[model samples]
Target: MILVIGGTGTTGRIVAAKLAERGHPTRIASRHPSTEGVRFDWYDPTTHPDALRDVRAIYAIPPVGEVDPAPIMLPFLERARSAGVRRVVLLSSSAIGPAGHGLGMVHARLGELFVQWAVLRPSWFMENFVGEQPHAVSAREQGEIVSATGTARVGFVDPADIAEVAVRALTDPTPHNTDHLITGPEALSYDEIAAVLSEVSGRPVKHRAIDPVGLAARHTANGIPPDFARFLASLDTAIAAGAEDRTTSTVADVTGRTPRTFRDFCRDRLRGDRPG
Candidate 1:
């Protein structure tokens, strides 16, 4: 059976659905057991064994931000190995570094584990456009998207494609112990993204530049916690410094199809109904 952590989340939900559709017994593990799935909590180690029981494959979605996920991930890996799990797929970030915080530590360590593993290092998800990022939706309603990034272009990937690649990796299980740097087809700036959103939504949305600290405050004012708000603003600063301005073919390379373009994402998400 396949167990998907964060199964109700963006990528995990899609992966679990696809796996189930393919005749695999998929179990979803998360803090909320309200759904018809396994109830598991990362903070509660006692629940881990019950969740890992008879599981052969796992989709690991570590907690967000630069927090230490090793304590959670390492135990899961050790237990999976002990339980005779065959395959494990981990969702990693492109921004992760060997010495950086957050998923970076987990990503680096997952590489050394004595099991068949695949790490997906994807760029900023297209979901951020309509779901996560306040600027994108605000732009649709208020006609202006603000960012600290000016000209830096990012190959914003779709979580759907990331899930597709992840599903393939989980079921197929070839070329094990490899990291895939997934990215969209083209790189575009927030200016271009605003234009696409405007066209898709039939609004006059524009991109506005804001100072990093000011953006941080705005994020907190909009409900993000202070520390996470500062971290997000720092990420924008990283973007402005050209940290995430690269493109890659890994998405297509793994999925046997081209990654979805931002325009495609805009049409499907910004214009059409999927989910928030």
Candidate 2:
């Protein structure tokens, strides 16, 4: 049996569906129980056993924008290991540094567990177009996508590819305990993204580059905590300094297919004329 934490989420949902399609008995972990499968919550340790019971493989998706995910992830991972789970896949960010110091802590521990593991270090998700990215919404609604990343290019990856690779990692043992840097077909600046939006969505979407302090103020005004807003601004500065422009063939190397292009993503998700 395979257990997927954050199963209701974008990547987790796709992973669970793919696993089930391949005849794997899949369990979904969420706070709310559902008819699809067993529901479990990561925040509450009491729910771990019921979710991990009889599971042989696991997919771990830690909460996003989290500076400290260890407290929740480590305990759940240890529990899964004790339950005899042998294979695991972790959804990590590409923003994690070279030494993998911060979030790498979790991957390091998973490495010590002797399980067949694959850490997916994916770039910015294309899902931002359709999901919680307020910049995209602001563009569609108000004719502008604002960011602090001035002239920075990002290899924005599609979540579907991430899901496909994750499923293969869980089912196949070849790429055991390795890190895969997943990215899209090309790197694109936010300005280019805005242009794409303008073309696809049939609206004049513009990219507005704000200073870091100004961006922080906007984020705080949008209800993000001040500390997190400042942190986000700092990340933008790093990106502006060319931190995330690198591209890789690892996605195709692992999944035997090229990653989707941002144009394709925009065509599929944003081409429709839906009012946001």
Candidate 3:
């Protein structure tokens, strides 16, 4: 059996569905016990035992809002290891490395605990345009997207591609004990992305670059925590410094197919979903 943590989340939901389609006995773990699965919370220790039951593989997502997830995750992973779970696939970020903060600590620890593990460091999701990312949706509605990234570009990857890679990492016999830097076929700036959305949806959209500090303040004003808001803005700051402007072949190499282009994502997901 496979246990999917954060199972109802963006990538987790897709991962669970794909695993189910492939005949895997999948159990979803979440804070709420809404589905036919287990209730699991990283901050709550009592929830771990039942969730770990009869599970051989785990799809793990670290608790959000913490600069270091190791305090919440390492203990649970220890329990999982003791309970005979062999394989683990972690959903991490492309910006984090072995020495970075937050997920990086978890990534380093995963290597020490499990011999069979894969870390997926996927770039920004293409779904951000049509889903929960406020800037993208706001662009569609108000005709302008705001960012601190300036002209820097990102090779935004598809969630489906990330899910497929997670599935393969979990079920494959070979232990891909390495980090996979997943990305789209091409890099695109926020301006280019806005142009694509405008063309696909037949609407006028523009990219507005703001100061990183101002962006952080804006996010804080919108109810995001001060530290997290600053951290998020820092990602854009790094992008403006040319941090995320790269593509990778890991998606094609692992999934046996090329990563979807931003144009493809816009065509399929944003073509008919224009803002009212």
Candidate 3 lDDT over 208-270, as tens digits, reads 999999999988987888998999899999999999999999988998999888888778976
Q: Cα deviation of 236 in candidate 2 (Å)?
A: 1.4
Ranking by TM-score: 3, 2, 1
> Over 4 Å off in model 1, which ranges?
131-133, 272-276
RMSD of 1: 2.8
How many pairs in model 2 have backbone atoms within 3 A of each other, for residues 3 or more apart or on separate chains, i.e. clashes? 1
Question: Roughly what TM-score does model 2 have, to 2 decimal places?
Answer: 0.93
Task: Name the regions of candidate 3 deviating beyond 4 angstroms.
Answer: none
Work out the TM-score per prediction. 0.91, 0.93, 0.96
Report every candidate's CA lDDT. 0.82, 0.84, 0.89
Model 2 lDDT at residue 59: 91
In model 3, the worst 10-residue window by lDDT is 131-140
Query: lDDT per residue, candidate 2, 1-276, as tens digits?
Result: 999988888899999999989999999887665787676766777888888889999898986666667776887788788889988899987876324445678877778874588898899888887645777668767898888899999999999999998999898857467888889989999999888888888888888999999999998998888887897898788889998898899889888999999889888887556556
Q: Candidate 1 clashing pairs?
A: 66-102
Residue 142 of candidate 1: its Cα lDDT? 76
Q: How many residue pairs clash in each candidate?
A: 1, 1, 0
lDDT of 2: 0.84
Would you list the rank order by lDDT, best first? Answer: 3, 2, 1
Candidate 1 lDDT tens digits, 147-211: 89887888899898999989888888364578888888888899998888777877777888899
